[model samples]
Target: MRVDIWSDIVCPWCYIGKARFERALASFEHADEVEVEFHSFQLDPSAPEEPEPLLSFLADRYGMSTDQARETDAGAGANAEGEGLAYTSARKNANTFDAHRLLHLARERGRQREAVDTLFRANFGEGADVFGREALVGLAEKAGLDADEARRVLEEGRYADHVKADVEQARALGATGVPFFVIDERYGVSGAQPADVFTRVLEKAWEERD
Candidate 1:
């Protein structure tokens, strides 16, 4: 079984969905046969590389007051914790192009899953700035990737097309949000659905294959 997940680094639901999916995989009898691939999807394609503070960005975009933003943040933080991700004050959204590049490198090294997990932890758990080149290189290094090679790729604007292509493919596949999962490239499951939902889908796919 193959699962291709389209998600963003800063997406709270993606993190939660990841955890849920992991749990589902663990519970599945044929876990060892499952292959998971993480694909890139930017929440704000037009967002600047260095945007304003997340609160301000949300406030302006949604026309919400600062207080409302803060309240929402608190609620999101609690939800993130429930999903096993720690949320801190250091959280901010940065341009994820470089982060996506690092992910591409991880795929080359056959460590894409680890890279994705590290990226999510850095952005949501530790509140690291994922959009910065240095931060992205650092995360790649932590995930056992070659830091120098990662930097070179980012500096040279490599894999930008791959990221864009992935986004376009997701759109063509009718994915409108992050945490979108395509099972066996035929079944689509959106959002951070419950583990039971994922388990049921996986079982159905496996049964159909057999």
Candidate 2:
């Protein structure tokens, strides 16, 4: 079965969904036969390359008080911890164009999953600036990619079209959310569903494949 997941690197629920999917895959009898692909979906395409403080953005966008934003972040942090991810208070947001480009490069090297995991950790756990070429090169190197080559690609802005195309295709397919999973090109699961839901979808896809 082929599974295509559309997610952004900064999305917390995407990380949670990844953990849930991992749990389901561990028990899947046909896990070895499954192929997974990560596709790009930018949550804020117009966001500046170096975004302002997240709290300020939230305040301006949602007209929320600082206290309300803090409370919401605390809740999100707790939810993230439940899925084995650590949440920190450093507020930084940036355009993820380069991050998605690196993902395509990782896919070409057959290390897309590893790249995804590292990217998530670098962004959420370590608070690395995902939009910066230096950060992306570091992440690629950590994922076993050649740091020099990664830097060249980032500097030249290679794979930008591929990332944009994936985002456009996602919108054409009516996906307006991150962490959307399409199994076997037919079964669509939106959001970070429970592991049981993923397992059921996998089983059904496998049976139909036969």
Candidate 3:
């Protein structure tokens, strides 16, 4: 089975959804037969190139106080802890175009999953900027990709079209939000659903495969 997941690195729910999906896959009987791919979806494509505090962005966008935004983020962090993920919610929201481009490069190197995990960790678990070129290079290396190659990919803007195409496809598929999952190109699972939901869907898709 092939599972293509469209998610943004800055998306909190997407990170949580990944953990839930992993748990479901771990319990799947045919886990070894499954291939997971991550695609690009920007929650805020026009996010500033210069860094800004995540709390300020949240408060300004949602018309909430900074404390209220922090409270909301803390609640999400607690949920991430349930999945054994260390989420800190103290990072800045960045333009993820280059990060998405790196993921495409990682895919060619057969390290897409690793790249996805690293990006999520950088933006969520640790207070790292996924948009910074140096930071992206470090994450690429951490994902088993060549650091120099990763730098070139970002510096030269490689795989940019692939990132755009992924976002376009997500829109065409009626995905209005991040963390959309497509299984076997036939089954579409949306949002950060429960692990059991993913498990049952995985089984159903595997069985329906012809």
Q: Which stretches of candidate 3 lie above 4 Å from their native place?
A: none
Residue-level lDDT of model 1, residues 58-167, one tens digit each, is 78889999788878788768777887677764578666777887798899899898899898888878877788888888889999999899999989998888899999
Worst 10 residues of 2 by lDDT: 51-60
Candidate 3 residue lDDT tens string, 39-119: 999999888888788999899989999999999999989889998988886789868888899999999999998899888
Q: Which consecutive 10 residues in model 3 have the weakest lDDT in total? A: 87-96
- Give lDDT tens digits, candidate 2, residues 1-210: 899999998787898888888889889998998888999999988878975666666677789997787787777677788877877646578788888999999999898999999988877787667677887898899998899989988999899999989999888888999889999998898999989999999999889884
Residue-level lDDT for 24 in candidate 2 = 95
Model 3's number of clashes is 0
The per-residue C-alpha lDDT of model 2 at residue 25 equals 88
Full candidate order by TM-score, most accurate first:
3, 1, 2
lDDT of 1 at 150: 90
TM per candidate comes to 0.95, 0.94, 0.97
TM-score of 3: 0.97
Candidate 2, pairs of clashing residues: none
The Cα local distance difference test for each model comes to: 0.87, 0.86, 0.92
